[model samples]
Target: MGSSHSTPVAPVEFDHHLVSALADNAAIPVPSPARQSTIDAHIHARIQAELQRLREDEATVRDEMHAALEKENLDRERALAHDQDSAASSATLLADLDQVRAKVDRFHARRDLSQLPALREARDGLVVCYKNNTSTPLDCWQQVETFRASVSELEKQHIQSLQ
Candidate 1:
């Protein structure tokens, strides 16, 4: 806005002086070869040490993961074995319960039989008669003999079933 002319401006006098002085007397400092090699060796040693540490850390992590996987496999095997054992034990217990229930059912069924009821009533009546002395041994002998015969018949049936 101030000047529309395209002509170049004059250079500052101090810039010319500074450039001449640097050209005549300035010296750039460079590191010695021995010092630079020592620095390079130090950097290389640090890099190698860091790489070794990382490798060790990676190996440790791999070993830990392998051990964990082995443990998990072992635990899974133990759990499966335990489950199988539990299933076998449950089956055995169920079979035993079934046998016991069948025996109870058989006992209940036998109790309901007409012969068993009559035998029980006859034996109880004979006992009462004996306790009251209302009948002589000769008088109740027939009922006692009948009860004994019925029990002997039931025992024979049981023995035949076992055979």
Candidate 2:
């Protein structure tokens, strides 16, 4: 019901006196020398301790899972082997592994390579940025993030692709 225009009008004004936060040299609060040495140390220590505990728990869980899986796999293999022993004319290693599942794992692993280029490019860009901006390492933050993201994605893909 209102008038239509090609460009919309702004409710606010854009003034010439714009201030950049980076350009502002305002004072920031800091701890004293002694405090600075220990500032956030407790938090950091707690974080490291928690990380270690989690890592240990993960390893324990992984081991238990691995053992359980292996035991399960072994049981299945033995059953299959028993069946094969009863019916099969000859025994072989291939009898233990399911060919269809193996093929699927292989196919997934092959398809998972699609992101390798992006990962490599991110790493190369990070290296180049580091070389060019040695004085300002912060410039490489984007590249670092890209690389981390790519690595994380690849890890997830690998985990999913695992047989």
Candidate 3:
């Protein structure tokens, strides 16, 4: 509940009024003893109000800081969980990769890697197409497609020979 009789103002803001009046060279009448006591009481009330406002502001900042800490803790927990998941997948992938590599090595030992002439010509054409269409590489799509078709044909031929 707020007191209707007193509208609180900070001590610094009240001093600003006094400073401006003095800077304007306004004449100030010397206060009688009764007015002096009244002025003293007013200044005391303003100081109390300023202290109260500062305390409230401090409380709000403290609450915000605590909330930010809580959020950071949650983020760290999520990151740790993600790292654990990646570690598990990485271990499984490494094992699979080793098996694939071993199979490939064995296959290479058994087969001769003869370079087919058509595959070589297709690759060369694709290279030239890329060089000529430097600024617009999409123009090399035809060359790329031709190269892919050449590769498919060669793979089919290789499979037939293996059989």
Please name the candidate that would achieve the greatest TM-score relative to the true structure: 1
Q: List, residue by residue over 18-75, the lDDT tens digit for candidate 3.
A: 8888877756567899999999999999999999999999999999999999999999
lDDT for residue 35 in candidate 2, whole number 0-100: 86
C-alpha TM-score for every candidate: 0.37, 0.34, 0.34
Candidate 1 overall Cα lDDT vs. reference? 0.79
TM-score of 1: 0.37
TM-score ranking, high to low: 1, 2, 3
Cα-based RMSD of the predictions, in order? 27.1, 29.2, 19.2
Name the candidate, 1 or 2, with the larger TM-score value.
1
Best first by lDDT, ranked: 3, 1, 2
Clashing pairs in 2: none
| Winner of 1 and 2 under lDDT | 1
Where does candidate 1 have its weakest 10-residue lDDT segment?
A: 154-163
Model 1, 1-163: lDDT tens digits are: 6477667889867688889888776565567999899999999999999999999999999999999999999998788668978779878999999987887776667765565776677778778767766645667776778778877888787656534
Off by over 4 Å in 1: 1-28, 85-163
